[model samples]
Target: MITPKASPAVFAVGSLTVDVKGTIGGTYLDLTSYTATASSVSFNPLGGYDFSFRENDGLSSKRTLSISLRNLLIPSPPDYSESVVTERGIFVYEYDMKSSSTIAVTQPNPNLYRYAFNDFKLSGKARHTDDTREITCNGFFLLQELTWPL
Candidate 1:
């Protein structure tokens, strides 16, 4: 007799939240989608003819964040500008598919993952007549972390 094979578990994004506090202050609850591009690392090879002999420059390129939100039917566009170094900037949160619910499983299941970004600035913006807006933010997030809930 042959046993049946089991399918792998599925992963998905459950929720997203973006909070901007600086020259502009608002909590974007209507997040349609968002994308955070990875930052580039800077390094140099210390020894010749050996790729393994490398030293980190202790620097990384800035991260690019693109966000789409549902139009809130406002009269004017919100201001997101810099004026003499504003206080706390933007913050983004992403939760896994298991964040909203609990599951009962016989085996060990992976805990949900969370990603948070801080110190972002508005780099670009766009508005569409179709009731949607896209904004881009650039930031040098020195503290980027992914961790599970306690």
Candidate 2:
């Protein structure tokens, strides 16, 4: 019998809520803020994927904050295929402090202090069918996690 190699670990799925506040840099940056909820179990694999390189807690975007998610780990080893797939769901918006109305995931033009979504919501039963699918559980599920940059 062959067992599908599992990830090193799995983060239990749950509801999450977060609120972010910050101040801009040299020019008095205060144009960024975020409120989020932890991804819960959904029919889709990306129920609660939320990770970003923006300011988690700071007076400026000069510094960034992030965390790693287990789902980001590819179950297939390097020996096999090297396919890059979406592991989770992430929602990010950018605002030009002065122009609070303009919200976007990224700046119209790239800048030194810009950021983007490196991850998305991964929900239950995700990637459960890469090449195999036979769970003892009544139902299988996938969970996308948020990972931070080093």
Q: Per-residue alpha-carbon lDDT of model 1 for 1-150, expressed as tens digits?
A: 965565322232322222332212233333322332332322223311101101111223212222211211111112222112125633322111111111121222333322222322222322211122233222211211233333
- TM-scores, one per candidate: 0.19, 0.20
Worst 10 residues of 1 by lDDT: 47-56
Worst 10 residues of 2 by lDDT: 74-83
In angstroms, the error of model 1 at 55 is 44
lDDT of each: 0.23, 0.24
The best candidate by lDDT is: 2
The regions of model 1 sitting more than 4 angstroms off are 1-3, 11-17, 20-114, 120-122, 127-150
The TM-score obtained by model 1 is 0.19
lDDT of 2 at 106: 28
What is the alpha-carbon lDDT of model 2 when measured against the actual structure?
0.24
lDDT of 2 by residue, 1-150 (tens): 966555322233322222222322323223323332232222224432233232233232222222223233321110111122244533222221121121112223322112222222211111333221111101112343333333
In angstroms, give how far residue 108 of model 1 lies from its true place: 14
